[model samples]
Target: MGLFRSIVGGISNLFNRNNDGLTITKLVDLLNQGYSLLQINSNIYDIPEIRTAINFVAEKIGSVPFYHVRADNEGNMDMINDSFQYVLTVRTNKYQGPQVFWTHVATMYLLNNNAFIMPDWDNRGNLTALYLLPFTQFQFAQEEETGKLIIQFQGNSSYTFYYDDIIHLQRFPTFKGGASKQATGNYITMVNAMENQAVKDSETSGRIAGLLQTKVNLKSSDMKKKLNEFKDTFLTAENVAGLGMIGSEYELLPFNFKDTPLNTEFLNSIIKQLYNYFGVSYEIINNIASELQYEQFVDNTLKPIIYQIEEELTYKLFSKGEISFYNKIQAETVDLEISTLAAKTAFYKEMSYGTIMTRNEIRRRLGMPKGPPELDKFLGNKNFQSLEPGIYEVGGQENNPEDGK
Candidate 1:
């Protein structure tokens, strides 16, 4: 209760001081300005390429499970695999589950260069639920004298927290710019080009029905009325399909379009550029990537993002000693492919020769159920054995010089 009161008092002091230094009102005004900057800039999310890039990264990361781990003094680590299962699998927040929450966070981080998560703590201060704030809705500022970060949410809401209480995932490195500062979105530079192309495409399609001009020399008193009737009938859809004129004096001229249709190759090139910029190959988008390419994509592009999230989560979620003892988050690698029984046999044979991996370990890697407890022990081929002083034995027979004769 005392700690809570102190937090409230500090916030009150932040809001009231208007003349001496930074005030809450001034901060709010600054935040509003920052928000306006985002509004004026074209939203990268609106562009198809940007959306595809963001989705590709976010979905890949979110699909991997995040685990808590235990570690020993000797630096050995093992997953407390099921410890975070409830939080990760059931619900991370009241309204959203872990997948949705993480995907949204990842998407927002890619768009604005930052993402935030506020954990809902129980009475014991353990995390009970989590909420992801919209990146644009919050402004980050630091108190001038104290150097404490202040997070101001939309409207009159404001909250100050220790760095650990809030998960702040930043995509780009920055020396300054507290929380409010944003690194430019990766796709922002191409927005105008994409928009221009879209407009050109639309205009080109509209001109496919070429312009028509009609000329008539009229001498009668009812010429104006006749001209109006002629235009109405001639311009109709039915008449355009099968245009005909009863009078020879009426001359209809069709102006053929000279400009070629928008080059699909050029448009496709732009899309390809966007994909390449985000490290997504055409084979991936078209679903033609081979197994090797897929693995490369995950390792080269996706793994770094997963590592970033892992480091941040590990640091923020646990104390130094606690982390060394029993807390970690890991992103699981994609499942390995064993296409045929021959491939599986070859892989197992290689792994088993030197007792490199136990039977259960191989089974686990192959996604099969665990074997009996004895299978947990390392086993090698009984037929091949090492004899005294580098001598060899094959098929239970000793290759001794005396016995060979």
Candidate 2:
């Protein structure tokens, strides 16, 4: 514990002060011993606070931390923290790679420097000496370029850090303001959502939906635009508003599906048509099939039929109200009606037989047209001629109902 505190204390002191001398140079040299050479802001290393931060990092990492200096005149110092059993070498503009693990660790720890070493902070600040500091956003601004490691900060505000120049972990302010790491809750939520999507795809239709949904092979520019817009909407709205807390002023917010009635209506329509064809209800069919499969089944088979019905429904339905009603069905529902027995036969096996329903039932429920006589004829034929029914005459035409044709 003593050693740990000392390590923290040294780094805090180093970044909190601004001076040029052996202490700062020594800190730089010590960090370099373990890390490979990389470029750093020469001006930054000259600060006393930064030097101290380096020393603290070296002490805590229990490994040599090295820096690369362009000039030979830049003095190198080696320091060993016996309890932690590590050495440190600090330099400038020279190191890069996995060997820089100590550098990254130091940076990660120093991410909280702003909360502790504020400009008007008291020298006797109670929190300054603690190991785990309070949550504060990390800020990253480009300080110097040492290969891929870019030292960035959130704001123009100058704060001392033990290892301010570490890779990837540099502090940068978020667009909404302030610097902060992703919360544990956020991570767990995202992971769980992803797992749920996977499980749903495996058991059902094998497609992605809901939060974090992804579409495959959608390379069109329009699709890309839609995807980017969706991403922006999701990221911008996510938890940043601090909603969902107990006692907060709750608003009747609409869900994603609610805002867009097209998807739901379309789904409802397709499922109904399929249900009619299969002699089942929407709820029964959905209950049996997985969410992922439902969409695919509709897209591949129903969408084209819907398009065809939409093209012809205008002229076919005669009553003014029924015309309007049929139009609504075409606009809102998926059409899976087959024009010929051959087409129906081709898809008979693929079509989900259990719980199939018809478009007319769905349309009537939604106040649409009674649908074409063809729809009824198909339903009648399917019901009577199904393999389960032992292959009866389709329309009293099996034996003598053919009427001497």
Candidate 3:
């Protein structure tokens, strides 16, 4: 435990890309120990569609309210406002608020299909702050003796962590769960290649405008030197562009990339597939989702991720004994229809007849503060007593239509 805490204590060191690497000029030396080199290449995050989808999901789920509710064996549940609650509701860590913290976890989870969050502790092992591990990936294995889960963060050096100390979220896992190391790799490879090709084509025009051909004796080495000089003097110069009078000695052979009809429709089809893989749509992200669309989004997309989060937090934050007592974490789902006053009252009217939720609960759902204790009790519906067929008669006597009265 001491070693784990010490490792997490160096969280700042994990993000320091510079000053940690040895100064090496040679290509082979950069690969040596004590030197860290990051290869520059296009990855999934470079794609705009993926970024939009990820940000949309993270924002929607991360910004919602999470409550720490304790239920007794008799079925009475009460919300508990504790240090953990404060961490979840207000501030999560030294630098990040709850939304930022959750967004970080969600983004990482979407990128890699797994994200780990570590709870910072003080000298007495009390929870001080909560945040995601900055590393891109981690390896997990079981202890030989205790069978407890162990985590080694992949980096220049592995940092060991007990699974008990971290909140591990994995998506699309098989039996062993190791295959998620590059979950996005399978989908993004084709998309990456296509986007890279598109980028190269886009950058083609910027590289060179055209070639200058000579009408004179083509093998004049002196003319070749003069041509290079002219290109360096005129074409490559930044300020001189758009209109230049070329000498009749040269014909402009403008180079243009073939206007190949890239299967843009095909690209979009694949993009849609990617979006569906992450469970996002253009409507929800753009704030144009209809009420039904929003509800469906919540049910199909956000609920699964949020459910996983709740289960993880509940199990990790509470011991087995506490879990038996019904200590749990829950997310307060947001409804799009409740934003308007008319819809709020109409929904409240419907719920009033159902007699399930108390007034305070309804108020809380409607974005209002809690009502007085008197309104916290559930209301009884007199209309619910007519389930019996005989009880539905207008008068005390039964109707005699069958008897032809």
Candidate 4:
């Protein structure tokens, strides 16, 4: 059966919540049923730091425009305006454009280090639409009788599909038939503790203003009243900065937390490792990166992902003979696409004069929508051009290039 029909059949089989791996310290409603607080604390998407890093990558990778191209005799690759490239660069399906589709795919890939893309095929096995497969868990096995490989997804409901034409992206594959399952496991406990501590600190920050010790032997009820009075005097927003005038017999031990923040440094230190694991720095995540830093991020982090997608798309979408003849995908990182405004302006200055790039091409880099087809041609430098030795229309007379200005 076709993958789409199978998915429609399996729509009722949403995944059941499973928390088999974690020893729960807290339960989180932020994530879906199976994901607990402990699970999220361990560098999953729920953690703010980790999510920021992952989203930075996902959005950037998704934002990158792709191209389908073929090589000529000069070894230079030229873009081909075919349906394949159009679908990848403009629209993936009826519902999603390039950004949303690729962002989701990247998120899934980064989250699991494994993802599957089912390429719709025509009657002749030519590529058509693409779909991102949905599954909470998956496994691969071979049929004993047919000896054909099969992939099973145990989500809300279980469904297995033949491995035919299924593009599997896996990192660190293992004998167990999937990517070697590794996550941010090095600092889960510490991160959980720190996160909890921070929450507790935030909750009781002002309430625990100081300790009050008195020599007066008061009843429990009276003591509660007195404590309330003290808290009201010092903890209340109106008198938070006011000095307390306590009796001589009482001791005032103020809880000094103004100078020290809760778990910020320690948490950042631990989460920095998470960022490093995902191949992003704070500069990249926060978008405060320099040109050098951005380039390094692209080279160190984004290149691997782009390469994997390109290779897989090329191989799966084309036959070996087709590939040998140079039909392939080329994921060109549009210079103006992900570049900063300053970089775009500088690039425009450099290329706007000479016929280096077409107007629409430059406009694309600047994040502008495509203009009319007339702008598709290269721009000529009008600043200085050799005047042809012919009549020029000027002041009711013809001026030639040889006629000096």
Candidate 5:
């Protein structure tokens, strides 16, 4: 029955035509052909460096909490702190949670240069659930006359979704104006090479460990019998471990194949290149990055991606009025610890004395609880206070111009 169904499905797929009259079979064939064009290739997930790079960025982005805020008529932004925030950051849908969904989306975008989010709307068009689609499974197409975009999920059991109902995130810009696109650049080649090198190294190591060869001198007539006897006696694991041959005629020789040492430096170089390509520093990968460098990594590499996602979410999820009021999503910064208490103290002291940041802002940076409303105001040391137009005092009380008179 299953075989019959599969056959029927295959037949249906062969004849299945999309809105543009392209058969599913032809599309599948084209996709297969495209994949075959690459000499050495692998899934992004299979490559450790690629996986690490993508996950490093994705996990950091996912770990940071997402918040929504709207600007009032007077233009002061306030946090929404509502159900929508929960839906967006905690639980995306019934089947999948937010972190997993976002991680998958980030992985897709990094690998394929595209990601998709589909919102499941309720009766009144309110979003009930958000789902991340497999970007590779879907292709975007446009109507000739109406110019409406369509998403076709290619498989034996296919599904079609409207473009308006889906949120698309594209990494590389498509200035030529095509609906369907491939991933950007030749990073896949690097990933493939790295994977291939690792495989070769593993195979070489296995050969060195387990491979054995023996040379024996025996009469031609007795060769077969002697070989069988040798296999039964010395080749057994127990005999190989403990047995000692008392004959000088038989010799056990280790296989001596001089192999070039694995080019570890070359592998390291490739790893570094992959890390740089993905905007991950070697220090971060090796767990040796300073707090400042880690912060900079987040800012320089991950923040742009966060901002992109925020902008897209804001535009797609919110209404026009909400958007006009500057309602948007934001990813919180991941905090890093100072090297020492002295460093932390000096940092906070400078921040406070220079009035560089408000007390609450300082607390937030230090991963502390927010202080009272008064702490929200930026206040410098009394010694550094400006008094009476241009007069300033380092330590003494302020001298009024009238008092001198």
Candidate 6:
């Protein structure tokens, strides 16, 4: 039944083949004659009027998109007509009795209709006229070097248009909007402010130096006399800028002291350790300490040895292909977990005044991250959990699923 319907449909199409100006038979003939709607060569080149018409429409639209115009032969023009296609024509001086003639193919797109129709040119007596509907078919031909716009449109009838043609036809308004432009005066004002701050900072440094000499013991002859000249020179010339400590009535240090240099060597050692482990600078270490002073003070002992120990541990772990093991504490040994206790109790503790506080001090010396308040979260992490009672279980095997199978 399907085959019978198909046969009838073919017969019907065959009879009505020529309804749209050209028949299937004529199209086959054109192909056999080596001429198609999309011909490799067209005589259109010789027709200046037609060439002028195409250029006029193209220029009015906008810059010809790079993909639209194509070149093949030395002198040839290829015309592609899609549903959104426009083909402008200019009448030649000599006119044959017209079945139809067209001047300008007005730009219009018929999306739903899916056709490229050439509209009829409005004609008065002397002027010729023709109708153009959106063409249902299109042609892509290699441009020819010469000839009139009239092509031997006899054989090649089946045509196709590219989707790019429809996209190209879209109109876009020129955009001129942008962010507000900064005035020259605004930039000059910023430059001036920056320069003024730099000058003020220089003046402040000078004043600070004067204050240190006058109010601080820095320049006292008696103070100088107490120190060996070599030690004095070393201490004086180092980059040990002092910080002023202002104390309240209840504070441990009740008076405000300015420019009292702290131990430079100690600070430098701390900075060196931080830099070696983390690749930070002295300035960065100082900034971190100032920002989080309590945390910095807690890890005071670590300041001297963190970088070295961390480096050594990392190397050892790599070479051994394992971490140094730690023993897990049993429930009964919970009392031995000194790091968790607030104070020490006299027992079998290693340190004098044996207590959890002392163990914490030791841990701080080892440069560990802070202990957790909740034991579960803390013990869950291997770094913290390893501190439990047992020694490491080295060379332990973890079963592979594949091996078990």
Q: What is the clash count of model 4? A: 5
Across 1-405, the per-residue lDDT of candidate 4 in tens digits comes to: 123434443221221223121111111222335532123124467677777877888898887777788887789887877668778887786557888888878877777777777665454333456776654377777767677776676644555665555667766566644463556676656777788877877777666666777789889898888878776765664476556556576678877654445667878888888887878987777668788988888888888888888988887666677677787887768562447778777677677667677888788865799999988987777764788898764343255444543
Candidate 1 clashing pairs, residues 3+ apart or interchain: none
| Highest TM-score scorer | 4
> TM-score of every model?
0.65, 0.17, 0.67, 0.68, 0.64, 0.14
Q: Candidate 4: deviation at residue 93, Å?
A: 2.2
Task: Return the TM-score for candidate 5, rounded to 2 decimals.
Answer: 0.64
Backbone clashes for every candidate come to: 0, 66, 0, 5, 0, 32
Residues 1-405, candidate 2: write the lDDT tens digits.
Answer: 233333344343334223321233443464555432222332333333333444333333323222211112344323223211211222212332322533443443333322211111123221111121122444333334332212222232434343321212222334533244422233334334444554555575423344332334455686677556665655666658743332122222432432222343544454354333322334433356543454454554334433432343233212254333322112333222332345445444334242244645545534788978665433444554537545444455657676544
lDDT of each: 0.61, 0.35, 0.68, 0.67, 0.62, 0.28
TM-score of 3: 0.67
Residue pairs with backbone overlap in model 5: none
Single out the weakest 10-residue window by summed lDDT for candidate 3.
Answer: 19-28
lDDT of 1 by residue, 60-93 (tens): 6677767676767787768663425456666876
- Candidate 3: tens digits of C-alpha lDDT, residues 1-405: 233434455342222123242111221243343332112112666778888888888887777777889888788988888766888888887667888878878887787777777665554434567656555556668767677776666765556655675677877775644245544565687677777778877777476556778787756787789688777766655456654456677787987545553577778778877777788876666678787787688788888888888998887766677777788998877453354466667778788768867888888865799888988877778877556555342433355544522
Ranking by TM-score: 4, 3, 1, 5, 2, 6
- lDDT of model number 1: 0.61
Off by over 4 Å in 4: 1-43, 76-78, 124-126, 136-164, 173-180, 206-208, 214-244, 247-250, 255-262, 336-338, 345-405
lDDT of 1 at 211: 29
Lowest-lDDT window of 10 residues in candidate 2? 113-122
Ranking by lDDT: 3, 4, 5, 1, 2, 6
lDDT for residue 129 in candidate 4, whole number 0-100 = 64
Off by over 4 Å in 3: 1-42, 123-125, 181-259, 286-293, 334-347, 369-380, 385-405
